[model samples]
Target: MTPSQNFFSDIHSIISQARQNAVRSVNFERVVMYWKIGQRIFEEEQNGEQRAEYGSFLIKTLAEALEPEFGTGFSARQLERFRQFYRTFPIASALRTEFSWTHYKLMLSIDNEDKRAFYEAESIHNLWNARELERQINSQLYERLLLSNDKKAVLAVAKKERLPEKAEHIIKDPMVLEFLGLKQESNYYEQDLESAIISHLQEFLLELGNGFAFVARQKRIHLDGDDFFIDLVFYNRLLQCFVLIEIKTHKLTHQDMGQLQMYVNYYDRVEKADFEKPTIGILLCADKNNTVVKFSLPEDNKQIIASKYELYLPSEKQLLEELEREINKEKD
Candidate 1:
């Protein structure tokens, strides 16, 4: 490239970065302004002996006086949100500058404290903007992770208190694929699903969880005279292992488990480095019987996991019901 072209490129990059920094500064200032407003409103409410009635009256009157001058940002509904925001995150020092006001607004709707904290930490860690964070929350990412893992461990990993030590802690079951834009009613082959995932690889990785870097597609391994292909391969830095995923258009069976196990064994013995952890094999199937999965693998097995994949996102009620059923089945 000519020196002139290089110079222009450098200047463009500088301007772009500067604009981004300016926007971030403005966004953080707005977050701080809202927090201060909420703090003042909360303090005023505490001063009144009848907190609930007085607080409602205070916000109503305050909005009436302020909205006309400052625009709709000071509306009664917004003021109430501000009040709730301050109450939700009481410590000013805990507020992360990386998070915009919109991020907090979305988080405020979450009733569970642990769930809220998980989203907060994940957003900061992943640099997720408002839209992505909203998508994950709506998709019920936290509840999905909680399905087969302990709550404290899940929170600990999400909050970066510790890295994930187990595949189940990070690999979500019944993976949501609404972003893939596939018709739920239509039948699809394994290759079609694989192609869709490749096309929407960024969203796929986000759905796959943290630290996953794509390695290969249709990875081929030669076993003696025959050749077999693995559907997808990913390396997860957080788990420090290779995650081999085999897509199945049908319900999972013992044969499917054995196939994944063989691929996992090959990866562990041949591909895995001495310092790296064991490879984890996931059977991403249309349906899976937990009882069949349980008996298919050895009692002490932790490397093989069967996860059901959905072409579309499931409602929170449906996910909760599925979790409840699984819990009861385990109890049996």
Candidate 2:
């Protein structure tokens, strides 16, 4: 590229950055304004011992007075949201400027305090927009992580208090792929799934969790006179290792685990650097049997993970069932 072209690119980037900053500043001001309004409303409500009826009447009166002058933004529903926002985040100083009011509004729906904190810390760490935050919440990311780890450990990793010592700390099981736009009933090849993931790579990364960077697709390896192709390949900075994912349209079997183990062995022997950790392999299948997986790998194995993929988001009932199953397995 010419020097003028490079200079123009730099100028364009600067303009974009400035515009983003302007938007952030406006959002921060709006969030603070709502917070203060909530604080005042709470303080007024606290004056009387019968806060239930009094608070309800106060909000209705305020809406009646304010909505007429200031428009629908001051409607009763909005005011209640503001009040709840303050209640949720009691300390004004604890509010994050990086989060928009929409972000907090979404989080306000989450009743679990630990779950809320995990999402808050993750949103700040990953710089998720309101949409991404909503998606993660809807997909039950916290619950999925909880399947393999405790609540405290999940929150600790998200808060960056300590780095993820292993891939399972960040990687989730039963990965959601609703954004891929593939219908659950549709018959598609492995390549189709791979293409869809590439097309929506940003969303895929979000679903894959943090610190992952795309490396290669259908990565080829040669041994002796034969050639082998691995599916999606990613490097996770948090784990400091290569993540090899192989998509299987059918249920996972012991043989499939061996194949992935071989691929992981190849990467660890040839591609892994002296400073990098052992390569991790993930068998992403449509279905998997926990018993088969357990007996297939070594007792101390940590490098290989088997994750099931769904074409769409699982319903609440389905997720609850899965959670119960995981809990039962842990007990055993």
Candidate 3:
């Protein structure tokens, strides 16, 4: 590059850094202010003998007095959220500056403490914006993952201190693909799902979980005189392995599991580097029978998984039913 171009690029890079730094500073200050506000409100609430009565109208009175001077940001509802925020995160040091107040508010709505903490840590680790954090929570990402793991395991992921060591650690069954914009009645092919994922690859990766990067589509593997094509290939930095996904628009079958197993074996034997982990193969299909999946793979299988894919989030009732079923199955 020319010296002039180099000079311009340097200036632009510095400007970008400066802008991001300024935004971070502003967000940090904003969060600190909210924490202080919450602290003051709590202290005030406990100051008098009739604390219960004082607390009843404390927020409304504060909102009325503050909103007139400070603006609509201090609405009663928002003040209550601020109060709840302080109650939930009693320690000021626990609040992360990378997230905006919006992120905290969304997390505070969660009734489960473990779930809330997990989401908070994950938001920071993944650098998810408020919208992304909200989307993940609303999609029941925690509950879905819990279906595959125990409480300890679920919390460990949010901590980001533990990385995925096995296939189950990285795989989420009944993966939600609502972002693909496919209708329920539409007769879509596996290729259609593949194309949609490619188009919305960023959102797809978020749904896939952390540390996934698109590698290839229809990755070709030559066997003797024939060529075989794998549907989608992704490299997960966290797992240090390649994720080979095979899209099936029908219920998962043992044949599908066998085919994916062959692909995984081929990649592990031929494609993986000496330092990399074994390639993980996923067969994502429209439906999955737990019995079928259990019987299809070896008792100690970890390199391959068969999971269901959903074009939409299941309704709350449907999700509850599914969860109960999973619980019962575990008991059995």
Candidate 4:
């Protein structure tokens, strides 16, 4: 490399490292400050004769006084959040530096303590940003993982002790494909859905869960003088594998599974590096027949997967029913 290139590369590396450290330090200090502020507010309120009135007035008064002098970040609502932050995580050392105040604010909105803790730990382990954290929480990632895996296994995976394997780790049921903007029961072409996904690619990536980086759409693979185009291709950093996705507008069939398998095999043999993990194939169809999927793939199949996708978010009732079914299947 040229000297200028080497200098720029080193500078970039230093800047990146410095930025990461700065973020961690700032978040850690801010959380510590908020916890102390909350504790102080709580103690003062307890000691005050008019506890209820005092608690209500204190934040408002503080915000009114501080906003004029200190500028932004001292709103009444935010002060209340700081107070709650202290209550939620009383220990300063327990606060995770991976998440910012915004992440904690979202977490505090969750009512269930156990669920809150799970998200918190998972966010820290996954290094998710505030938006990513919010998406996972909103999607009920913890509940879904619990439905699919044992409680112990779920906790372990959340803690990053045992990493999740296969498509199940990354795929969310009733996927929030609001990006597609296609109405359910409306006649839509596969090309239209693909176009929508491309248009709102960022949202689709977020919905696809963490670690997925978009590689291509309609990626062509050549084999034996024949060419086949895969609907989508993504690389999962966490799984260290290339994921080949096939979009189907109708119910999944054995032929769809076989096509995906063929694409996966081609990628594994030709495109994927020797050091990379096995390629994973997914058939994202409108519907899937579990029996067909099971019998279609080999008995010892480990690399290929098939899943159904939805154009819209499912109701909580539907999610719960699916969870129940998964639990029953696991038991059986």
Query: Each model's C-alpha lDDT?
Result: 0.93, 0.93, 0.87, 0.79
RMSD of each: 1.3, 2.0, 1.9, 5.0
lDDT of 1 by residue, 153-264 (tens): 9989988999898899999988999998989888889999999999999999999999999999999999999999999999999899999999999999999999999999
Residue lDDT tens for model 2, 1-332 = 45798899999999999999999999999999999999999999999789999999999999999998999999999999999999999998998989999999999998989989999999999999999999898888888887788778899999999998777899898899999999998888889998999999999999999999999999999999999999999999999999999998889999999999999999999999999999999999999999999999999999999999987877767886898998999789
RMSD of model 1 against the true structure: 1.3
lDDT of 3 by residue, 1-332 (tens): 45798898999999999999999889988988888898899999998679878876898899999998999889988888788888888999887878887898898888988988889888988889999998888778877777778878778866876876676765776688898999977898999999999999999999998889999999999999999999999999988999999999998899999999999999999999999998899999988888989999999888888778888877656666787899999899
C-alpha lDDT of candidate 2 relative to the true structure: 0.93
Query: What C-alpha lDDT does candidate 3 achieve relative to the native structure?
Result: 0.87
Identify the leading candidate in terms of TM-score.
Answer: 1
The runs of at least 3 residues in candidate 1 whose Cα sits more than 4 Å from the true structure, single-residue gaps closed, are none
Which prediction has the highest lDDT against the true structure?
A: 1
Instruction: Give me the displacement of residue 172 in model 2, in angstroms.
Output: 0.8
TM-score of 4: 0.73
Collision count of model 3? 0
TM-score of each: 0.98, 0.96, 0.94, 0.73
Output the better candidate (1/2) by lDDT: 1
Per-residue lDDT for 173 in model 2?
85
lDDT of 3 at 306: 79
| Count of backbone collisions within predicted model 4 | 0
